[model samples]
Target: MMSVRDRLEEVFERLEKRASDERVYPKVYWAAARAAADAADERRRAGVTLGPLDGALVSVKDLLDVKGEPTLAGSRIFRDRVPAGEDADVVRRLRQAGAVIIGKTNMVEFAFSGIGLNPHFGTPGNAIDPKRIPGGSSSGAGVAVAEGTSDISIGSDTGGSVRIPAAFNGVVGFKPTAHRISLKGAFPLSYSLDSLGPLGRSVADCIAADAVMAGYGALVSTPYPLSGLRVGVPRGRLFSQTEALVADAFEASLRRLSALGARVSDCDLEDLLEQMREATSRASIASVEAAAIHSDWIETRAAEIDPRVQKWIALRLATTAADYIRMMRKRDELTRAMDRRLAPFDVVALPTIPIVAPLMAPLIADEKLYNKTDTLVLRNTTPINQFDLTAISLPIPDVPLPVGLMLVARHDQDRRLFEIALSVESALPH
Candidate 1:
């Protein structure tokens, strides 16, 4: 049996090996891990009680400000920028909980896409299938956790960046209610939609990380029980395009939940989807806010950006002020509609990604297919951001490729959602 110290050292060694490959990220800072481990050991020796994550090794998405590491956000344009003076708020919380910040992980440049391609820095390999994508812009962060290089990974989720990879890589990924966790030092993607969250191997692991990041006390021990829970299955377009494996796995999951005594019912919230599309038509919060954050850089370093990313930014820049205002107004309307529709169920359930992770080559070659798959991949997850709901993507068993079963709850019901998720997790086939 290995001690926590020994285990963490092993993780650090793995980080070194992965970083040395130079395929995951442009650079890694090992000194930070050493310093954190020493501090953790000192605290333990002094007889100080620690949090559940004490001494656990963790990875931060490169988009985040990790002191002394450049906030690349997966772009070469900011490669020369100086290191951060302070850790992002989430990083600070992890430190306070005694987790070691091992190294920065790669991401899609500026987190512009769900596909997780970084032509500049090689994309992280998916743990389940090397040839497949690891999912982005939290690409490498998910890999770090799935590959056992870290106990937890802090990544940003704006339109499923965190959940997409976690699902594709067969791990647990959680996105808390919007604004539940502070985003003080993380790079901006979409100020309105961007959220900081974690990827881990188990629901318990995700819950532990979330508690610390949210500044909430330790998670209360909640037994998995589904005696009276109402879980809505959003039928129709939401589940229309799921692959055979994913569809079968989801149906089996519902049967298991039924055996566990959950009240599973079909729900049609087609209105929610319509509202979301309408809200984002003129100028999405993601486009408008990200454009604002990168306007200066885009103007000066346009040529330095990835062609796909540059085009995305260009589209944002083309939007008029009226478009932005219209988008915001419609966003508010959509939020209210979602809240009303979701009120009947404890949590709504859906597949995390419509299709399994596609081959990397085709996605890169055909921009149309890439855009199409990207929208479908994020369709279920993005609605939570629009409604400011708390959600979690738990792995569905027996699926050919990793596919996640997502559960969503109303704002401020994060803990409740987690409790429900535990039951759902157990109900899925092993």
Candidate 2:
């Protein structure tokens, strides 16, 4: 077995190598990590064990505060901003758990896009296929883990930001319900919808990381029995416009689960879908909130903002107070409608994305293509956010292309969702 010191040193060495080779991480904290690593090693030598993530290497999204480091949130807009006074709540927890805090990974500008593209700091290419996107706003967090620079990545998921990248990059991403994890020092995309999650190589790794971030000591998830487990599939909208490869693999996965004694059923989601449609009829709660957060910057520093991001934030200016109030009301109604609808089933399963990671070239060249593709990429995963639910995206094994199987639960059912996800993850091909 490798000693904690040896493991962390190895991780830091890899971080340096990865930093030189890729644009995934814009900053590196070797000095801090080295000090933390030595401390963890000392604790181990004294027979004092740390938390579950003791001495593990971890990277945070730049959207978080790391005490003394200015969070760029993947934009040049904050290049001259002052350093943070303290770590974000999640980062503080990780440090307490003895994790070697490496450095901040890059992200989409202000976490506005599902497709990870940052003109200021280069977009991190996908690990599996460099030609395709690495999904974002947690883009670099996903790639850091995929490239083995970090054992786990702590990221924020507002609207498929975490899970979309996980699917596209072929990893596991778990988004806990909003308010479950502290967001005190993290930059906000949508106050109402934002949640913290971890992207890792496996379901168990994510469980461990989540426990640390949630201040729950260690991971305590147990696998639920798969036999006779009721897995619901939303009948419509989820599968519309899905690429053929994703459709086939998702159905095949269901068949495999059924073979393993799990009962698969198509859920009657007409009413739930209607509520969701109303909830998201116009500008997202994110755009409005982001507009509030960045309006001053957009007004005076318009040239500094990403055009795509600026356009979305600017839309929030057009949102009247009446529109905001109606949106909130619809949000409440939809959350309740989906919660009641999911109460009877153990979990709901859907394709994480109806499509694979789209190529980056065309999207970069054409604004129209970027808008259409971004909508498609976020379609399946965004509903979980609208309903204030928790979800995990697990890659389908043995598939010709990377496809994620998303399992969802009602709000605050994060533990139950993890148990269910583990069982399905085990049954699915690696």
Q: RMSD, each candidate, Å?
A: 1.8, 1.5
- Residue pairs that clash (backbone atoms under 3 angstroms), model 1: none
- By TM-score, how accurate is candidate 1? 0.95
lDDT of 2 by residue, 1-430 (tens): 6776677677667665666555788887878888988898888888887776887889999999989878888889797889999999999999998998788888999999999999988888887888899998899988888878788998899989999989988889999999899999999998898999999988988998999888887978899999999999996888899998898989999999999898899888877777767766788888888888887787678788889888879878878889888988888987887788888898999999999888899999999999999998988888888889999999988876678989998889899889988888888865
TM-score, every prediction: 0.95, 0.96
Deviating ranges (above 4 Å) for candidate 2: 14-21
User: What are the per-model numbers of colliding residue pairs?
Assistant: 0, 1
Model 1 Cα lDDT, one tens digit per residue, 1-430: 3455677678667656655565554555566677777777777788775788888878888888877667888888887989899989888888888888777888999998888888888887787887888888799977888888878988999888889999998999999877889999888899888889999998899999999999984787485478777889889888777888888877788888878788999888887788778778776678778888888888678788887787777678878888888888788887887888889998888888887888888888898988887778777788888878888989887767898888888888889888888777766768
Q: What is the Cα-based lDDT of residue 170 in candidate 2?
A: 84
TM-score of 2: 0.96
**Candidate 1 — which residues are off by over 4 angstroms?**
16-20, 25-27, 42-47
